[model samples]
Target: MSGGLARCSGSPDRDPGLQPERTRLAWRRTTLAVTVASVLAVRTALHGRAGSGELPAVACAILAWLGFVVVAHQRIRALSTPRPPLLTHRAALLTAICAALVAACGAALVG
Candidate 1:
């Protein structure tokens, strides 16, 4: 009766530990925290009277959030599966870049 690989059979990975759910929740929390910081950056840029410099900083902050959202959304979706695939190098790189952008914008705004 056995045929093909277990993955190909579309069997849901039995995970009694609920680790996947925990990971998904952690991702959601991280997204929320980053979003809050981004909003604060925008607020500072708009209200600080930084003039033209504000535009680029605000733009970068928003762009970073968007990039992070794309990656986080993908991860979140993957976590929904019973047996999610391993995170790829591309995804990790993009995530780091996005986070760096957000942090840079935050620092620039604060200073």
Candidate 2:
């Protein structure tokens, strides 16, 4: 156990906090959201409405997914670097920004 991986020395039947799982789920959720937006954008574009609201929605979704990817990579790096808190904070901030971007896109679509 001298390398750098986080230890799971207690019991194998316990929850163990699930930090890695949460990070993976975050990535999955973001990716799904982006995919949905991309599909919608393509559909709208095919209908001759590319720059109305679908573009913004697609851009925001892609940006959010990219943020999630960054968070996932950071979490993996933290597994061997002892930098959990920093990665967690960055991920949270990125999520918040993505949420705001989504909201803004919604508002623009409304008006």
Candidate 3:
């Protein structure tokens, strides 16, 4: 039966159960995509062999997109769960790590 049909069944509404497995899967997908984007960002940023080059705005954009994905994944997870945010504090650290990696690449360009 469809989810709406199930809800209409005359049964007592227990609770809107969070689909943990699906949430986790979404996180996994987001992480995987971000990882790939990060690699591409690094490669693009390092493309010029020597001398100053234009800032790789593409990489910056990718990084920002990754951050959005992280936020989106977290939001979905929070909505699925009834308790306090399961990812509570990890989001900041994760974003920091990703940002640090991108920064390191940029620094290498300046070196």
Tell me, by lDDT, which candidate is best. Answer: 1
Candidate numbers, best TM-score first, in rank order: 1, 2, 3
Tens-digit per-residue lDDT, 1-111, candidate 2: 233323422325423565544554565676567556544544444465435556656566557656655665565555433224445666678766765665565555444
RMSD of each: 6.6, 6.0, 8.4
Q: What digit string (tens of lDDT, one per residue) describes model 3 on residues 8-104?
A: 3334542445354355556667667666766666666667565554365545646665775767566654544323355656676766566665656
**lDDT digits (tens) for residues 1-111 of candidate 1:** 122233324655646666666687788898898799789888888788556567888899999999989998999778666677888899889878888898898788778
lDDT per prediction?
0.78, 0.54, 0.56
Clashing pairs in 1: none
Q: Say which prediction, candidate 1 or candidate 3, comes out ahead on TM-score.
A: 1
lDDT of 2 at 65: 54
- C-alpha lDDT of residue 49 in model 3: 66
**Local distance difference test, candidate 2:** 0.54
User: How do all models score by TM-score?
Assistant: 0.82, 0.46, 0.40
Sort by lDDT, best first. Answer: 1, 3, 2
Instruction: Please provide the root mean square deviation of candidate 2 (C-alpha atoms, Å).
Output: 6.0
